[model samples]
Target: MQKKLLFLCLFLFVEVITAQQDILSEQAEISVLTIGPGALLNDSFGHNAFRVKDPVKGIDLAFNYGVYDFETPNFYLKFAQGKLNYLIGLNYYEDFFEAYISQNRSIKEQVLNLSQIEKQKLFDYLLNNIKPENRRYLYDFFYDNCATKIKDVTNIALNNSIQFNDPRDFKPQTFRELIHSNLNRNSWGCFGIDLALGSVIDKKATPEEHMFLPKYIYRFFEVATIKNSNKPLIKKSNVLYEKIDAPVPSQFLTSPLFIFGILGGFILFITYTDFKKQKQSVWLDITLFSLTGIIGILILLLWFATDHKGTHQNYNLLWACALNILVIGQLLKQKTSTWFIKYLKFLVILLCLLTLHWIIGVQVFAIGLIPFLIALFIRYLFLIKYYSNRH
Candidate 1:
């Protein structure tokens, strides 16, 4: 008799919780929360979340699809291979607002114009989404990230009835360009992105596809409409907090371009000195070969071994030849085989082709690599001539 009572109480508790989720108060509201970009590279693209509140129901919660735990098994490895699973996160609305506000990020809310039944439907969807089995999802930066989740989840809740209209004065841009809009071109972060990602991101994004960014989600949703009723999707909008505009201390001297330029200058100086003295710097050659070879191998892994689509068709490998690693023994030798001279010439040819690829827009490389690439071209030419004369 006691066991039966305990089971009955548990059932009642679950039923009551379900009932509460099944019906929202007439004063219930749903909105999309857009948080502005933060200073860090990871937070540079901004964020998006759903806000649900009801005074009568005493319910106010936030749901976002951006949560990822660093403690997850093989986190870095999975991230590199694009196999990491991100999670849907839940928070009290007050807590959510406080967190971003504390970080000095702007927060804007767009009150969705939804019917009572539609509001309940969306609320139900959010509750269902937070279940342990349903919470985790594969994250794609440009296609299915936190911002795109707002658009996707809304469409799902509304039964795909939204007609997204382009914002006023909207201009189409490539995925890479869209990302660049939020980044400093001279930043090391930007340079790393350019080096790691390939030409796949250069294709122009569709109007709806631009919602991949949180700011664009706000812009597009500002004019979005319900297809059947022709009513605006958003009832109103409010800026809860505005980010303070402040100048970021210039890191230009420490930036990728400056550092790479300095290194490239040193390499050129060494090569020039070697040229005039009728000698070669074996140690320098060995170092260059090792660095380029390792970089090439890593690029190959990203392109072929990993699931990263953006790392495909990378032309940077033309300059960073993986074969250079295998040919390091030739660099140490006082005299090299005839084929080694041909190999050096082939490397020079690869550099020429890389230039052609750049000119023809086959792939856009890192702008910070301009001086470095030029130095590499000259160095390869000198290496070829030196090897030929020595043989």
Candidate 2:
């Protein structure tokens, strides 16, 4: 009798869940939420989420594809290796809105003009996707991120029946340019990005690919339409919260350009002093070699050791040569070999090649590194001369 009762309860539970599958009433609404950028680097590109509301079913929730658990096994390691998985998150719509609003970020909502069937399909899809097994997805910065997922999932739900029209002021831009649009050019974040990421990001992104950003997601969706019929995709759009304008904080003192500029000047000053005395600063040479060698090794590791595609095709290796580390013993010698002078010349040639790469638009390096590169060039020339004289 107890076994039969347990079986009956299980059957009823399945039936209840099955019934709720199509429970969304005709009054259901689906919308996209665009949250504005925050001050932090992580939030600078903004965010996107889907808002699903069904008054009859008392279902109001936000669905986003940008979540990742910090406690995941090998989290930081996977993140650095670009092997981390990001998860789709489900939350109450009110909580989602309040969270962004509390951060003083602007929020915009676009009510989609999806058919009742399409709405239910999308809502159900989200419900199914939030399952533990289905929640995680391999996250790619350019191809498949939170913003791109919005378009991807919608098209999947609608069976690719939507057409995205270009905005009035649409313009083509490279991925790096697109990223730079959302960042301060001289900011430390930008400097680090330029240093770590390579030239692949300089390639142009397609119109659809531009939707990888949340702002572009909002822009394209605003002008999108149904394919079979030219019906608009967005029925209504409104700003839920508008951030008050505030004075931009000056970053000059803390910026990469400023810091690198000062360091570069010091290097030139030391080189000038060494040149005047007709004597080399052995300690300075050792320090510079060690720093450049370490940086070069790191770049090589980022390119070959990691799964990050953006770190490939780096030309910064021209300046930061790993061979410099192996030659530190030569620099320590009072009277070094003649080949050491030739090696210094070889380093200069690599710098010239780097310049050629830059001029030909092969790779766009960090502009903030300009002063440092110039200083490095002069120092290299001085070292070559000093070593040649000793030889």
Candidate 3:
């Protein structure tokens, strides 16, 4: 009995000592590392992570919230459904920097002006978050992404005492515009975003909401203050690495603008031929209606069925009308229904409304779509005239 009690006491003493030793030392430092954007779509918006370095404790680790486990079941489906889980990843600080460096991306670090106790608290919180059960979180592009995670965790560590002052050069912009700043306006990525996302992103984003992007996090942190004491939040800043310039070769033939321009030219040519011949092309009408209808169906599905918040309330439906599908049978008939002409007229009116929406800032559309919209308008006009002449 005495031997067992002695062993238990020793075990308890060792556990207490180990627990106490886990605390961060006064010399430890915590920083926010902002990685510049890479060439890939996934890395275009850049990334943010926490760096905890303690030379005395021989500890140097980076806590990143942007990692996704592609090996997860139904990865692509889950990503499309917005149900993919992003997990907190821990890596050695040197390894993390090296990876970014190899990609030719810049790295910037900001040492936060937190009290020693606050620093230790922040370190402890990050360590706790990296635990197996606590690591995974439902990823949200606008709200709970890597940059927002860093902002949120810092706020938590400071007990919500951080006051983010807007930087002097700050300009309020819509979420879509903010995203566009990082992407080439003529690129396929920009076109896809304008197509998939809806009008909800047209509203101006709040200053705090701007932290969703990593660069904004760095900018806001540079001017942020402690709420209680009104002290600056960042003590020092350093540029760890600067990206070297390497220009990407451009290919105009494969670009969206060029391809869409060709498509629009063909549409105009077909419409002109139909006008001169005083006859409609059955195949052309079928192709146009079918393609637009399919696109409309896809838009509707993305808006209603998908978990993507930005896809809701889309107004692109005005041009890609789903009603086009129902009237496809009329094109095959020798003489169409009386209401079919009116339907074509209605489509023309809807196109006008789409222009109105664009002008009034109801939604911003892809610039590459301009030629397509013009061609579609002219095609509808031709159809209206053809039906009227036959009637």
Q: Which ten-residue region of model 1 has the weakest summed lDDT?
A: 6-15
> Mind giving the per-residue lDDT tens digits that candidate 3 earns over 135-230?
789999999999999999999989999999999979999999999999988889888899889999999999999999999999999999999799
At residue 34, give the lDDT of candidate 1. 96
TM-score of 1: 0.94
Point to the candidate with the largest lDDT. Answer: 3
Instruction: State candidate 2's TM-score.
Output: 0.94
In the predicted model 2, the residue pairs found to clash are none
What RMSD value applies to candidate 3?
6.6
Query: How does each model score on TM-score?
Result: 0.94, 0.94, 0.94
- Among residues 3 or more apart in sequence or in different chains, the pairs in candidate 1 whose N, CA or C atoms overlap within 3 Å are none
| Candidate 2 residue lDDT tens string, 1-391 | 6544643553454346456655678999999999999989989999999998888877777889999766689999999899999988777688788889889999999999988889878877877787667878988888899999999999988899989999988998999999999999999888888888888988888999999899999999999998979999999999999998889978799788888899899999999999899988888889889999999999999999999999998888999898999999998888999988899899999999999988988887888898889998999999888878777
Candidate 1 segments exceeding 4 Å error: 1-16, 19-22
Q: After superposition, how far is residue 141 of candidate 1 from its true place, in Å?
A: 1.0
Model 1 residue 305 CA deviation (Å) reads 1.4
Please give the distance, in angstroms, between residue 326's alpha carbon in candidate 2 and its true position after superposition: 1.7
lDDT of 1 at 174: 86
User: Scored by CA lDDT, what does every candidate get?
Assistant: 0.88, 0.88, 0.89
